[model samples]
Target: NIINARLRGKPGLFRVALNGERIAAIVPQTDVVAPAKGNDLDAGQNLVVAPFVEPHIHLDATLTAGEPKWNMSGTLFEGIERWSERKEITTHDDIKTRAKKTIGMLVDHGIQHVRTHVDVTDPKLTALKAMVEVRDEVRELIDLQIVAFPQEGIESYANGRALMTEAVAIGADVVGGIPHFENTRDQGVSSVKFLMDLAERTGCLVDVHCDETDDPQSRFLEVLAEEARVRGMGARVTASHTVAMGSYDNAY
Candidate 1:
């Protein structure tokens, strides 16, 4: 129970009740209430509300803005290049320590849920494995969803499809793809279809970097939408960083 909590759209201090981890009720404190005792806390008229959610983040690549070199151009490709160089020196403890420290900061700000994209392009699957362990280590603090993301082109990288399949097989909760980076349009469409089919087979959620590009001709998002519609997986689908839609000839 929390006494003297100031909730939004309400007048005066309110007594907030809790059942386990959830808020049970809230009653106005019209009269002077005694100081909280036992497990209860006194809010001291401070605003009290629900926890926050971090919808999308790259926890695998956190706290490494400039390791070997800086992204002076600040382009997505340049950032990816920096990450590739950093991946060479990535260790399991390194990933977990950085991820845990970052999560601690996020939890301090009231975030209780997070979805992170872990790059799975490495042949050894180092980051994906480390993130899986971190997910279990911090289960009590927050709900962590790890995405098996292919930062490099799925069809362009060596044994790319196989690496993605192995990542999901290990412990990835969501299947991810970056279709716009493929060498050709046909390859992009093929990559999207392969990932959707893999998600359907594995019963995992789908979150694709559908068109992370500015080319107006990039149309991989259409393939993703069609696959989701055909598979009846709309609710389980997420398209992230789809910048190409903004460059379409007639678009919103």
Candidate 2:
């Protein structure tokens, strides 16, 4: 399945050729043969790059902004509490509908890849199951990567570890954690280590929601980075939402 297109970049027009899903050739328009009729898309001087990649998103919690209740406190904890209530009444069909609808919106925006975190804290693993279904259903339209995210504290939640393990065993593409939400800093560090070990054993990628709060003392990002370095995971590990890093003391 070869396809040809005239792509626009900073300098000038370029002829890009794709074989199946890979770029087989790229040459300046002047040096390339004119693509046959009906086989090319001349971008007409529009900047053409690879499709967008949404590295971090919450598909399970999306489209439920005001269900059950609103976040009166406007804090992450409040939002989590509200979501807990919302998921209590959410059915499988409801989750699938909202997820597919969101995927449609992403496809419309030229987003061809998405890595969505589906909460696996529930005993039933409802969100994880629904996301797995959606990931397969929308495979033709987008590269959907499902992360088994423990939105709650991994060690803090009694069954968090079990649920996350089940998610990986079933079909999750990545393992996720919320170290900043753990009850204590030590627990946070432990959770990061646990998640990294799970990823290593399962050969899955690691993407943790680390240091998302405004507290400058939230240093779980440091632990995550150090562990990734130690394990040689390199780019396969992604520590997202390091909001607290901006507030850290320069000397420290």
Candidate 3:
């Protein structure tokens, strides 16, 4: 029940209401309000605003800054190499421990949604399994989306195709690929086709690490966009780290 309706001028100054939730019925001179329940805010100095949203993050790779060695080159490839070495040492417990820590940080920052990629090329599938468990563990506080990423390369890595399929079977929400790292252009194109087909088969979203290089010749993003258009999976697909787009000269 609203007790006092106060208007200071001809139009309005400030109006306050109290029902299930207290709200400002009219605009206030200052962007401040009295504190309410559940807020750890000071009485009259706090301001009530909408909740926050953080859409993208890699929970699995986060917080593993340096283990065996550090990324000396400061390049993405160096980071991948460091991660690959680290992945070899990753146990289920290690992934879970780091993922939980990362999620805790996200919650503290008021982030409610996240999209993380788990490397599926590892035969053990430790990272994928751990993230799936973490998703359940933090469901009350955060929404998690896990992508089964063939980080090494779908065809280039041994049994990568099977690993990706198994990841999807085990509840990965998205299928991923790295086309530029494939052995040849044909392999790159085929990987995208294969990933799209897998997404169709498993009903998962598609995200690709495409053309993340400084070379002007990288054109897999066009291929990905074309395939997405043909398959009618436009926004369902996300092409990440297309830094090569800054150098491409040709259209198509």
Question: Evaluated with lDDT, which candidate comes out highest?
Answer: 1
lDDT per residue as tens, model 3, 57-77: 667788888877889889988
Better of 1 and 2 by lDDT: 1
Instruction: Give me the candidate number with maximum TM-score.
Output: 1
Q: Over the stretch 196-243, how does candidate 1's per-residue lDDT look in tens digits? A: 999999999999988888988988888899999999999999999989
Which regions of candidate 3 fall more than 4 Å away from where they truly are? Answer: 1-49, 250-252
Off by over 4 Å in 2: 1-6, 10-18, 23-48
Ranking by TM-score: 1, 2, 3
Tens-place lDDT digits, model 2, residues 1-252: 122334543465666676776888876654434546887765554556679998888988889998988899999889999998998998898999999989899988889999999988889999989889899999899999999999877899888888889999989999999999989999999999999999999999999999999999999988999999999997899989999988899997
Least well predicted 10-residue stretch by lDDT in candidate 3: 1-10
Sliding window of 10 residues with minimal summed lDDT for model 2:
1-10
As a whole number from 0 to 100, the lDDT of residue 9 in candidate 2 is 37
